[model samples]
Target: MTTPAGSGSGFGSVSWWGLSPAVDLQAESPPVDPDLQADTEHGTPDLSVLLLGSTDGRHLLRTLARAALWPQRRFQFYVLENNLEAVARHMLIFSLALEDPEKMGLQEKSETFLEMWGNALLRPPVAAFVRAQADRLAHLVPEPDRLAEQLPWLNLGALKFRERDALEAVFRFWAGGEKGPEAFPMSRLWDSRLRHYLGSRYDARRGVSDWDLHMKLHDRGARVIHTREFRRWRDTGVAFELRDSSAYHVPNRTLASRSPPEPSWGAHCSARVLGGHRHGALCGLRHRSGRRKPPADQQRAASQATPLLSPETAGEITLHNVTEVFREITAWWRPRAAQGDPEQVRGDGDGSPEPAGPALESFTVHFLSLGSAQTLHHKSCYKGRFQLLYVACGMVHLLGPELGACVAPGGRLIVELAQYLVDLRQEQLQGFSTKVGELAQTAGFAPHPGAKPSETLARFYKAGDSGSGCMDLTVEPGTPPP
Candidate 1:
């Protein structure tokens, strides 16, 4: 069971992809495309950004206007608001014109929200927008069977807006990494949407695309930035967090807030609120089994639901089907994995192995946030066969071996959060990685002695990999278990 020298997953020799810790320090940066540079010089900067799920057209238009840092340096914009009616409403209020519908057998456009607002007509721009709609209707040149192909004029130019049903196409555009027609970012900076916002600090560019700066201080306020891969996953099946503004039944916070002094477990899970407003850390749970059926209402509204991160598995899953998954992962999934059943090795679907379950109460799971690993290590419940899983969580202080020491003889340990946070927060990259094998070794575990170095993505620290037995679970932290 002894791992060979430079092979015990100790960030051994460096690799070309820089995936390994022992990666060549002399590795060069990814090459920038020469054509992209030429395009930048020639007026258009090959960069095209798509604003996804924009509720209104106002932000979309304003962001595009700001992103034009130079007079002629306009970036191409693709918008898909995920709501067809909202898109129509925005077009009506923004002085846009859609082709007449009589030729297409569709009913005439009804009175829009802006039209209903009597005061809106008093504004010069609003009155102009209404007048344009009347002109388009009176001067009907509607062509039959051309609604899908016809352009909707916004400010005299055709706007590239798609339907909500085109979610797949929108996601494909994001997921595509420098490939095919949607591969518009010709620059090597990063293959994701460029969020534009006005800067607050002096000397900082009036318009900025950096995520942290814009998301924190931009005039539009804090916005969450998702990786291209995360977006693709969300579009496919994952549900967005329940607290997301896009969720189906948005909870009225004033009525739903958890009474204060919060849960004792809140100490374990610390969320960083951006604007000094206290928002509880969102806990999304999904059953690895994927056997649980969704409720009748959720099933009907599934297509419109926003996606969320699935804690138990890597990809996206349902968010509304929460009542049960929470109970199952802590009570069912982890405990079953701790048992080491060969049948349970293959997840119910997808064919990939699921992480060994991290035990919590059969019903309630305490927070598994920033410093959760250390918190779990100190808790009595994590004593024997219990495992620890840190999903796309923040980078906090805790070593690998400190956690590896807690694994029982038949249990497993998986840590994606630490490596992810380091790569994302420190390296300023879209993905995550544990520094070579430093995380695993420090966690007091090693790659399975028999596994090849290429299998670094999922290094299962099997039971007995370290001779260290479970530590005394009696030493409790000052805050006793609820």
Candidate 2:
């Protein structure tokens, strides 16, 4: 079960666990799409990996090279590039490490790619690093098929290029379907764009950070299976920064159009099974390919799972937002009978302001943890019975659709996002609240007219009758609890 001594070089000398048994090299193949099969013909490895990366700036090529050296070699790669010069650099790296260049068909492709985008390619020093990493990988490729078996889940970061919106959902959809962490590298890799590329100024106000993206992914279902292994790109003397005044554009057309016109054979096999109680709770998760569902057994298991929220329940629940802060929002409950005005107090002779009315008839409040905002949309948990309050701007903007789905006809979603954050550029803050309201409305909540300016708040009511109109949570202006 163990890889012999001297194997898995440059991939950290540590032993990896959970590698599946070696695949039968001579076994009969299962029926697959002819196009996919054709891609594997002519001595190429059976397993395919799609790698998408940028040409310059800091990257994971070293990490990837280390992974390529992992014992087992069944993987064949399709390198796609977001940066115009990425393909050339990756090709150079792969060429140095990979065996049988003419047979692997890399050399010809590298020449073509370099010819097409040579102007934008990496500098000589970075090119030298790729070759060095490739040299390290060359010693590790004992058998390509074994490597393939161990790398089923590699290159998930590549999907970042494809699924820019709803990153959590897209990531969940992919990770949920694929084999577990055993197939990927055991290292925490920072997203490269964080340091070099500044996103829109408007998004900066909405708490859009790369950290938020990682947190969202974690919350949705992708766990980081490894500890951080720090790596930095060697300075090539050329400045990597994208100047604000320069017109920067992503040349994605070639990469985008490369996917086969027909759905690949692997699509059906990788469809994810939504499991446990969450199956019903997160009904918003749909197949990424939109082609097929998981097998019948998975569907049955999901259907039988208990629902998280019941329709007949009449209790209060408090949940935290993405910021992990628990803000107090008051809910009033009264005995069906015997209510002598819960808000009024009898006059006291001492003239001391009558204690704000005795605790309004004993009531129970159910406080749920943060990220309930995500689940609400999945389960239609709020059947328009009462209003929902959201305090975080990130939750409203980043996850509007999920929250909107929870609102039943006649329920209102009250969101409070302060407009005057001094850190944000004035241009970014302009119409910021209005944009948030528009985003919420688009997600399913119908706009309500009573939003006030002082609170920096917006009210969106789910279309329908709650019997009691517009239930607002009375929270004083202040920071939420940690």
Per-structure clash totals for the candidates: 19, 10
lDDT for position 246 in model 2: 31
**Candidate 2 lDDT by residue in tens digits, 1-482:** 11111121112111111011111111101112234333333422233221122221111222222222222223333333322122323333333332333443333333322221211223333333333433432332233354334332223232333232222222222222334322221111111112112223223412332332233323333222111100011011011211221321221111111112323313343221111111111111110001123446644554567455221110000000100110101111112123454455444788643543213111111222222434543443342222333333333444356555544445445454433222233455556766776877676776664443343445566665433344332422121212
Q: How many backbone clashes are present in model 2?
A: 10
> Against the correct fold, how does model 1 do in TM-score?
0.26
- Measured over all alpha carbons after superposition, the RMSD of each candidate to the real structure, in angstroms, is 27.4, 28.5
lDDT of candidate 1 over 7-56, digit per residue (tens): 12212111101111111100100111244322534433222222222223
Reference-based lDDT, residue 28, model 1 = 9
Q: What is the TM-score of each candidate against the true structure?
A: 0.26, 0.24
Give the Cα-based TM-score of candidate 2 against the true structure.
0.24
The CA-based lDDT of model 2 is what?
A: 0.28
Cand. 1 Cα-lDDT: 0.27
